[model samples]
Target: MGTYFIVREIQKDQETGEVRDGEIHFTDSNPYAIAYAEESIANRVIDLLREGTSLNNIREMLQNRHIR
Candidate 1:
């Protein structure tokens, strides 16, 4: 099997419709991000490296350190 790196844009709360004011995080074990990212990748709905999340882009995503 091959390795895959998934990138998802942090989204607001699905049920509450509340947009958290900080970075969103999901651990490596989070199944939801994995399953969703995988399906989206397979469907070609998003590029594997969306948001230019690669070694070369050099754009900073957030100012604060990771919460966890």
Candidate 2:
């Protein structure tokens, strides 16, 4: 089996802006996991874009799907 990082959505309090005590984890092997991973990669691409990284390089890295 391959190692997979678990991603979860957590609710926060509106007034205090504090994370709630518990989190909800979607099922393992869920398509949501893939979407979350892709979103994370996209965010990193945005960061690199802000840093003036070349678009071709960023696209290559995104193609690999290995953030960091």
Candidate 3:
């Protein structure tokens, strides 16, 4: 058995149109490993935007925090 990674696109209903949420899933050889490692990266971006954090700044912060 080996491990594999899955990436998926999530759609959200909005007033203007559908939104894409960046979700990542990690799985193994098991067939039932659907969305085993879902990450709300898009939501995190929204939060960071709301907090006035730019992409570069976020990257720097992440680096400083040793968050790979």
Candidate 4:
């Protein structure tokens, strides 16, 4: 099998009616990699956002970070 990367952009919070955050998911033939990669990338993005990084900037950074 091959590795797969899934990226999801959250548009808004359902209950609070606020804009939601983005998420990244990684999956492979090995299940262990998915768990670690998913949470790690998510938390990292959250930290970056909390540190005052704009969403657009984050998008740009991620786009630059990933070629495919």
Off by over 4 Å in 2: 1-37
TM-score of each: 0.20, 0.38, 0.30, 0.40
In order, candidate lDDTs are: 0.34, 0.51, 0.46, 0.52
Q: Is candidate 1 or candidate 3 better by lDDT?
A: 3
> Cα lDDT of model 4 overall?
0.52
Clashing pairs in 2: none
Q: Pick the candidate with the highest TM-score.
A: 4
lDDT of 2 by residue, 1-68 (tens): 33332334557989999995343333336544322334455456556655667767765775776565
lDDT tens digits, residue span 1-68, model 3: 23343334467777868787554344444364322222343334445545666657756655576332
Residue 12's lDDT in candidate 2? 92
The better candidate by TM-score, 1 or 3, is: 3
**lDDT comparing candidate 3 with the true structure:** 0.46
lDDT of 4 at 61: 69
Give the per-residue Cα lDDT of candidate 2 at 64.
79
lDDT of 1 by residue, 1-51 (tens): 232333344559889998743433323344434322233232332332333
Task: Order the numbered candidates by lDDT, best leading.
Answer: 4, 2, 3, 1
Q: Could you say which candidate leads in lDDT?
A: 4
